[model samples]
Target: MSSQLLSEDFAENIVTTARTATGDSLRSVTYFTRSDFDQLYLRDDLEQDADLNTFVGHEWRGYRETQNAYQESELGQCKFTVRSFENGYLLRVAEDRRGVLITTDGLSMQSYEEIAEALKRMLQDADDEEA
Candidate 1:
């Protein structure tokens, strides 16, 4: 990875960009691999919810079934996709390897779409960090 890309500035940029679309709806990031839930990232320090992880599991399965839909798009390269639920959306990253479960709440459909767009760029920029 490039030294500059690993700077705090880059990380902060991605976080700021994600918030632009997510607003207050972004709740947490539920990390997972193919087998099961792994880790999580929350907007604030708080108690973890078991049920939320359960919901993400179901959503990830549904995403696997519909993977073809996003496969041809730019986000597909990294297995990047978004799934909307009643409250928020899930941004799936590196589906074939490490997967991410980005959750949001109280966001409008437009916001969800916005986040989807921003997410792709964020992932790309984030990948630069790993390069």
Candidate 2:
């Protein structure tokens, strides 16, 4: 589904999920694709971001490229990749269903199940909104 079809609540869930993971240090979810992602989404927030917003004639492809690239590499299928940030670790989940789950480094073990459940529902919400 295109980002344009995503709802306000759906977008808020992204922010809320980030907050719930570690409570702070989560930056924005930039839907960068195969093009100049950083510049396009710099001023624009998640809610307003869309695939139709083109650079020249082609629009920014969004996360599909990154997701696909990860799948193609020798690294193989990744359930999750966590990299440390100044405040926390960035969790990238490239599943059959896709999106990022940001969190602090100190997020409790107890929170994993809860975050997973919430992410499942959030992706569903996005899918429903797209329809």
Candidate 3:
């Protein structure tokens, strides 16, 4: 399904940004809101299965529920989060109720940091426009 929260150009640009940054190691790119999600890109080698849905559901719920816990933490506001898996890593960058979940096959810290910063800026700009 297409995204309701993100514009078509926005979604496409996000996918492009991710693919350009991660190259061959990129696994999947999903854009999610608190209640809905859109899979923008999934590598040809990857299977389209229930796990994709499960991952989106898990991340969507986690983003909504976990932010509050960190709201008053010593580290201050959450800019993004990264979960490393056995074969890959999941990077989450969000603004308010919307976010992007990016999965990749082990990228360097510099790559992740760059992508997170770019995504955070995009999300923040979108949020600012909407407000």
What's the number of clashes in each of the models?
A: 2, 1, 0
Q: How well is each residue in 5-109 modelled by candidate 3, as lDDT tens digits?
A: 678999988988888889998898888887778888888888878466677778877776778888888998777788998978999987677889999999888
Backbone collision tally, model 3: 0
Best-to-worst lDDT order: 3, 1, 2
Q: Write the per-residue lDDT of candidate 2 for residues 4-123, one digit (tens) a residue.
A: 534455555666675666454344443322332221111132344434335211212233455567867787754444556575554544334445434444565556546655665666
| TM-score of candidate 2 against the unseen true structure | 0.46
TM-score of each: 0.51, 0.46, 0.88
Q: Over the stretch 14-127, how does candidate 1's per-residue lDDT look in tens digits?
A: 456556667676677554545566443466744565586576667667667667566578754433556667755666654343345567666666665565566555555555
RMSD, one per candidate, in order: 6.4, 7.8, 1.9
Question: Top model by lDDT, which number?
Answer: 3
Best by TM-score: 3
